[model samples]
Target: MLIFTNNLSENRNVFIIFLLLFYSCQGEAENKLLEVIKVKELKIKPEVLTIPNPPYVHLIESDSGQYLFYLNPNSKSLQFMNMEDGKVANEIILEYDGPNSMSRRSGIAGLENDKVWTTFRPHAIAYFNYKAEIQFKKDIPSGEVDITYVGSSFQKGLHQYGDKVFGMQPLFMNHHGMNKDDIQKHSLVYSYDMVSDQTKWYDVYYAKDYWDSGKKLSNFSWVRREDKLYIAPWYDHEIQVFDMQKEQVTIKVEAKSDHINSFYYVNEIPGTHEEGLLNILNNDLYGIILYDKYRDCFYRFFYPGFTDDEEYAIDKLWMLRNSRPFTGVMVLDKDLNIIGEHIFDKFQVHASSNVFVGEEGLYLSLNNENSPDYDEDHLRYMVVQFEVGE
Candidate 1:
């Protein structure tokens, strides 16, 4: 009996130690979360005689190093600046008309072997050389009516993937009276081949019954990490993962948030042009999802719910589009599981188009239009890091 009692006591002691270690490790993991380390000021010089279009810096890699490519439509020039140095390393002034004409509505699509690919018009992609001359241009034939975004957004233009490039439509323009047939015929993304000029549309799926209520959705937010594309449509309270390799939506998750789930659908349509603009300014919308390659995590942002009655920057259209009064981000793991959430009680990030991922951490822009230090010429990013807790 004495020996049995001693054995039982030993077993209990072992179990207690095991639980202690388990909880300790669990707590440590919970602590391994997001941390805003510092705010990085990227005082980019206006060297190429062009003004920045704001919140639209294109990132590219070259043999020399990585560069931020900015296409100035006003000056008709493209400037390449190194990440470390705020000065422009190279500039290419383009021609508007002639035999080698580059369209005014062009943007940097891809860079390869001292040449850059520019997408102009709905159906054309032009290639420009280092000497600021158009080498050649090709028109991609789309059988159906397609929408190409002019400015910066997640689905700005076609991106190079292997021998093909792909693009996504952020919203449906005629979603007001969209029928079952319209939604059925809609393709989520289109893939284009430069060599063949052949375009293929993938029949991507939407979150369960996103438009069944006959309400229109707003713009979409997206983040592409290698083969996975994380898309957050403003209408649906969910985020989906599209697998580039499989060419299908592999995962659809509704990681419900405190504020996102409460977003009102676009049930009522604005009658006038001014009313349409007012609708955008007064509604809640889903922003972008930032992927941390270094940490293999995700940050999904959302514009908090508000009404037209709220008197916060309602007069300025640009201000309402980029910087909102209160915005929040929900942190998720690689599997898209919600772990934590943080709301900027004060004006900070330009949620519409000002967040990016870097080697050090996730960079949230501090150039909110409502911010006290808001400078139209300069750009600032707040570096947020994820580290294991002590």
Candidate 2:
């Protein structure tokens, strides 16, 4: 009896310690968030959903609400859906066989007046109309610029800054057997005005910090709200606010997560709303990959822990490269937090490198679970229905 009592007492003490540890960690997570997002009740309709096929879909809105365009890079086709009645308004097939083009590293942009733009590296931006007409093109001049991981020394950190669009170019010198390392030995940031086609340059990082094991800047998204621009730098893991008026850096805040993958500015409607998305890698393969569909969005779902041992079930198969396992989407009320999430079983979403979300549903790419190569499936993109709230 004495031995049993001693064992029980030890177990009780361990339990208490665990409870305290859990609370401490939870409290810290809450504090790290900029603000606790709050959302009202959600109403979801699960029945009204559809799935369309074609592997990848890129969506674009004119901002004037005149049209919603859908670009399918796989088939090299463009389709327009009418927002007013939710119908197929028009579509055009491009001349290029998108999949045959090995260089995804190319640059493509969409304009308001049904105009499309693409760049062919170290050169100029090509303009194409809806009829796939080559309207205007210009070649980029040789100069030092800051480049980004998106492969485009131009498109990676490029954005429209009010009256003009600004692009950054990474420094590359081909003449002297010089590589990215040598470029990093110098400065990193450059800017160009789209309207004027004028260029300006700045060193993003110091020589020491660029090559340092620590203090590397990477994976950033630029969003312009009102007159200012906010950059969510992933490797630095911080949010930087750039004031356009002052033409200087302003606010900087530490992020809540270990890393941030992507972000978008959501100000179409209004009300101090912003959202940030992150692809959090874990010690294990199955980790919580976060996303913010809207500027200020929220989602809620249960995910595997960083150290859980459920490897064989979710990790090995590579079942859904385009579909996420946890849930389809999350709804947040302005502030970013876990208010509610839309989850469906028997569906998997693995890769989100390029995804299109619309009022009708979501379009994503999919591959055969059995065959992991391009020959069998050839990157089958599909559109699935996602209904939020119940």
Candidate 3:
């Protein structure tokens, strides 16, 4: 009886210590303030490009910083622009059938070796050279493994290292059939080898069963540096680092926010297209991650959730117009330690579609159609340049 009582007392003391440390860490995170060192605005005149529909833009800078490549992915075409002069340099009209045809027009994964690679709708990968010529096309091999949950889209964070490309692969047993076991089995990253024409899967660390219970879908944002691939799941506060050589998750960075809720399983919010929009607005963590080679750090960008008084009811259009207008960015060092967190006011800079970390500074693209400057005749965007400082 005496020994049992002593053991219980020791355990209680340890538990108390753990709680104190956990709360201390959380307090530090809550109090940490992100300071904006500087901000610059650049206006992009859209008339210089030729595309019927609005294009999804990605900024890629050359190593020498002399040229900036603007990869514009449209529904039926992929256009390349030189940001130096805001002019279309080359373009490829994507087709469904032909020698250089794609299964479907998706988005560009990443650019390397002067070639832009895209994830074809359903299950394929295609590469286009600088001259907008299709150079390589191959279907990603799934073998007997089921990949139906991914539907026809690939999540952001397409990365190229040597002869291989890495991106997220969502695994599900159908939305209606998912359970805790299925969610625990979710592996959200995959690699495609250009030479072998094969696809391989990598497992994420700290598998939390939020998706299975909530009937929610999963999305990911990624950043690749050298031999490491950094992955951030849309709904979770953690950022995972996967080592390419080991083919395993080697590090996990958790950046907890006081405004966000801990993992919980609510009944899947269901609607038409509005359902997808609602889920993202309610559940997403920092949705995109960018590596700043110049700053030797990483930036994770995401929308903060709405307040209770805002409105209990919302639709696709309503959410778009009234949802939290501002977005937050969390900066981290190479080790993924949280250096700071900052918010960009919507009035000064509304939601940013894409963020590029450059030697000059951080460039953000405000691509929303609802922007005050958005004009049908011109491709209007307010580009904000941020300089990180002490």
Candidate 4:
């Protein structure tokens, strides 16, 4: 009996040891899969420019790297700065009423052929030349017969392709008397032809799924690389890339994430605008996708969730400040295969702006004013540069 008892005890000890070894190996494999890339700081000349509320600053680097366009939406002005010394070359005041007036909220689309384009809410696209002169303004008509049902498109998703600009209308109309079926049938994407002065719609099926699932219309981003345009819905794990010439979705890439599938269903919430905002604030996985032409890769700036705690997630201010630390960036090759994933540390980068990939390296805005590393005198706008890793 004593020998039998001794053998049983020995077996139990061995099983416990096996479990520990297995778990330790599993942890190590996960760490190896997502190697944290290193960031190299490059200090721009101090006092070159003062950007108030740095988080709202939108930067567009000229193709020749000779100029930098700073779009300050808060100040309703666009400052053209010399890249060499950061001196203000020119300034264009974006106002509401005048010959040079544009929608104050109309965010910049991008720089193309020495011209900057900005999109006015609902249906206007304004173009400004390098000298800050308004070249022309185009109004895009919503093809919907029910003008009342027509919804606004997102400014960030606006892109100039060839002789036309491509943008997507909101999935659902927030106005009263709108039903689910009406919202689902709304046009997904629109292209305004500069030559014809006509708006055409493209058939994208997943866009219907967005309205059906009650996702917010503003939670989308666009990236154009050469002839291809990539559209990613912030709440969804998939990215659809359309061929500009064909005007059809040629490829669809789905990213793998454990937290993506854990989304809280919008169907459970009431269909009010307030409820929709609450749903997104509490449960959506927000992300932006950008194409890196220099490296021939795509980088996704993803925030899986605001917080694990349900109570803390409801606090708007707390959610905004802490969400950046939890943000993770995933790099994918041109083929859409994920190469690596890196979770940025607190104060390492800000999640407010889009990731800027330039010839120098990857750049991210920094706004942690409380950090010991923060320098107020020299740096009005802090930017961190990271070297891409294999």
Candidate 5:
């Protein structure tokens, strides 16, 4: 009887051990199910040599690997680099002090047809080739539906729908405050056909009550996902999504913040491909959110600045919010939940400056006040680097 009792006790102990092992393994598997992303720092040097300026880079397909074209529209020049050898291939000036003079503020677009196009303020569109040879120059018509005194907020231009290329024109004027003057100034959207080189303009709208309430047509804050364009009309609490093919405003997303100034589409890389992140910068402390379009989930990130959210002269600040300037490499995905945020709260960065993401890493150019090339009061650019995850 004693031996039988000892056997039963040993069996019960063995069963308890088995249960614990199974639960432990199950917990680990559940933890692994969550998405994980890491943000690291990278060191990258310009392949082509040039004075460290606000640079925009494009990867051109070459016979070998690829050639990265660093177009500095600010300086009106092109900096070409061979990606294979990590060396500067060539640097050519895109602008010339001809009989006509021009002032450009970073609207350079590299098309697939081996052409680079840029607009210099109120009225000039210039096109050049890989060799920096002038192909064509065009002027914006002085008479265009009578909305003059428009201070240019030249955002990105170049809308690509499948095989077709479309140029985007933003006729957005600046208004400091929500005043009566803002109601008079309207924002216009224009599409330039890349093949035929034809320009067409469209009037964007929000709610009728908002429009009648003295709200302005201000969609300079634009971003593209696939072929569709998402624009945030200043002063409106909603973001309107436009379908390029249908030529219609299809979707309107209600923003959590009152002032929806800017919106960025979080692109997919690896672990977080299923869910996308959308960043909307507003006047309040609630800045951005990770939005899962598929699952219909929202995750928010809150970081604030000391001063008002000012977009201008950002490339000029040495320390942002009294801290060392930092750059965001990639969005993070932690256990099916998206995390990780590096804010401009530390340093100011301009949306106009050239922002490039490559196989090497993410590169940013902030306006540096400490540089001797420009006076401390003047605007100068400083380049910085950040690493990405696989």
Candidate 6:
């Protein structure tokens, strides 16, 4: 849509780059990314899902087959539905009352080779067989530092490769606060050798001057493809890559959100409980970076933040204290270059617990609390189908 003169001034070119960056950020990055990035809505329908609970889903490949799992609060167990048939595939019923009980709030880390790993709040990891039996559980291992949180959910949890179990050690800070140097020193990734009972922590932390207080805007999600692990922190405007083969944090790509125009932060620890809750709600965050294995590309989801008095911010506080900011997606290629971005209108699609990627395209929950199509029995998804250019 833009045509330059045969020769243009340097200042003029620099000014135009930020708006249409594909042509100007760098010569190599000009890959016709914006021109080709297209998306349209699609409906999977209730018939395709046939799911028991709502969709706060995690896709996993077990020894038997591929399945989508969600925490069924009504049944008090993880219900795995067959991805192909949409029927009940398997269930992991953990006992919270028995001698070897699991946490009532057991978080799904990851499942591999019929072995499912679950984590507790403060710090704990337990391995469960497909038959709903705990093989072994471990608390925070004896360490030199204070690790209040040891594990994460979905793809960021315990990854078993070779003889070791690799996992995250995200730094969830306390009320006292931490300095920049101390925050940088804390390793956020670790690997445990199951055979030797030894652990190794990787030297990776928050980006320089990246954290506001380390408490708020600290949730992160990741996706591992082959030897490269892609990490998307809650606050950073960049994607950090950890090369498992190299055994070090390698490259970082600057994949900033175009639609999150006004970004906010919870800088100081709030005095009151309600004050802290307000700060948490009134902020923007990068969430759940997902990799589409079929397409060999990545999608980084985000919530464009708004103020307390914004027109479409729902109620005064909002949704059981969980702020439902309008969702957006940044599309990228496997090499980590920003291709295009889709910006949804306010109250269009809900955040987090709803968005996911599939073979067809990125699936977004159309069941917005404010939408007229919202219902209890039938949940719907707006499949962002990518289209080819003429």
RMSD of 2: 15.1
**Each model's TM-score?**
0.76, 0.50, 0.76, 0.73, 0.53, 0.78
After aligning candidate 5 to the native by TM-score, how far in Å is the CA of 242 from where it should be? 2.0
Worst 10 residues of 2 by lDDT: 275-284
lDDT of 3 at 335: 75
Which candidate comes out best when scored by lDDT? 6
Candidate 6, superposed: residue stretches over 4 Å from native? 1-56, 60-67, 82-87, 104-106, 142-144, 211-216, 261-263, 271-274, 308-316, 320-323, 387-390
Query: Each model's C-alpha lDDT?
Result: 0.61, 0.38, 0.57, 0.56, 0.41, 0.62
Q: Model 4: C-alpha RMSD to truth?
A: 12.1
What's the C-alpha lDDT at position 119 in model 4?
65
Error of 3 at 35 (Å): 2.3
Q: Please, what are the lDDT tens digits per residue for candidate 4 over residues 1-390?
A: 001012445533553453355345444233113444333454444224454223223445665554455664445566655645656667766556777666443456666566776666555777788656788777667666332322222225567678887776544444234545565456557788888888887765354454455534435666777887777766677788878788888998876544454454544446664455454445646576767655566777766544445343234444354434456677665666555566666555655462466544356655443244555433233232222232
Q: Which stretches of candidate 3 lie over 4 Å from their true place?
A: 1-31, 49-56, 60-76, 93-96, 143-145, 149-155, 171-173, 194-198, 209-216, 262-266, 269-284, 307-324, 347-352, 367-390
lDDT of 4 at 303: 64
Ranking by lDDT: 6, 1, 3, 4, 5, 2
Q: How far in Å is the alpha carbon of 8 misplaced in model 3? A: 56
Model 5 residue runs over 4 Å out of place are: 1-36, 47-53, 59-63, 72-76, 83-86, 98-106, 142-155, 160-185, 193-198, 205-221, 232-237, 255-303, 307-352, 358-390
In candidate 6, the residue pairs with backbone N, CA or C atoms under 3 Å apart (3 or more residues apart, or in different chains) clash, namely none
Report RMSD (Å) for each prediction in the order shown.
9.2, 15.1, 10.8, 12.1, 14.9, 7.7
Candidate with better TM-score, 1 vs 6: 6
Q: Model 2, stretches more than 4 Å misplaced?
A: 1-68, 82-87, 96-105, 141-158, 168-189, 194-196, 205-218, 243-247, 258-351, 354-390
Cα error, residue 139 of model 2, in Å, equals: 3.7
lDDT per residue for candidate 6 within 1-390, as digits (tens), equals 332222335323642453355434556432332322224453433323333225347756647775667766666676776655556667777678675476643477776677778776677777778767888666656244577666566746677677766778765454246655666666777777778877777887768766554533455788888877887887777778988777788998777776544444556756866565565556666777888765666878877665555433335455523425466677676777775666576666665665666544566766666555655555455656432121
- Residue-wise lDDT of candidate 2 within 208-264, one digit each (tens)? 332234223234434444555444433343444556655555665443332222222
Deviation in angstroms for 55 in model 1? 4.7
**Model 3 steric clash pairs:** 46-379
Sum up the clashes in candidate 1.
0
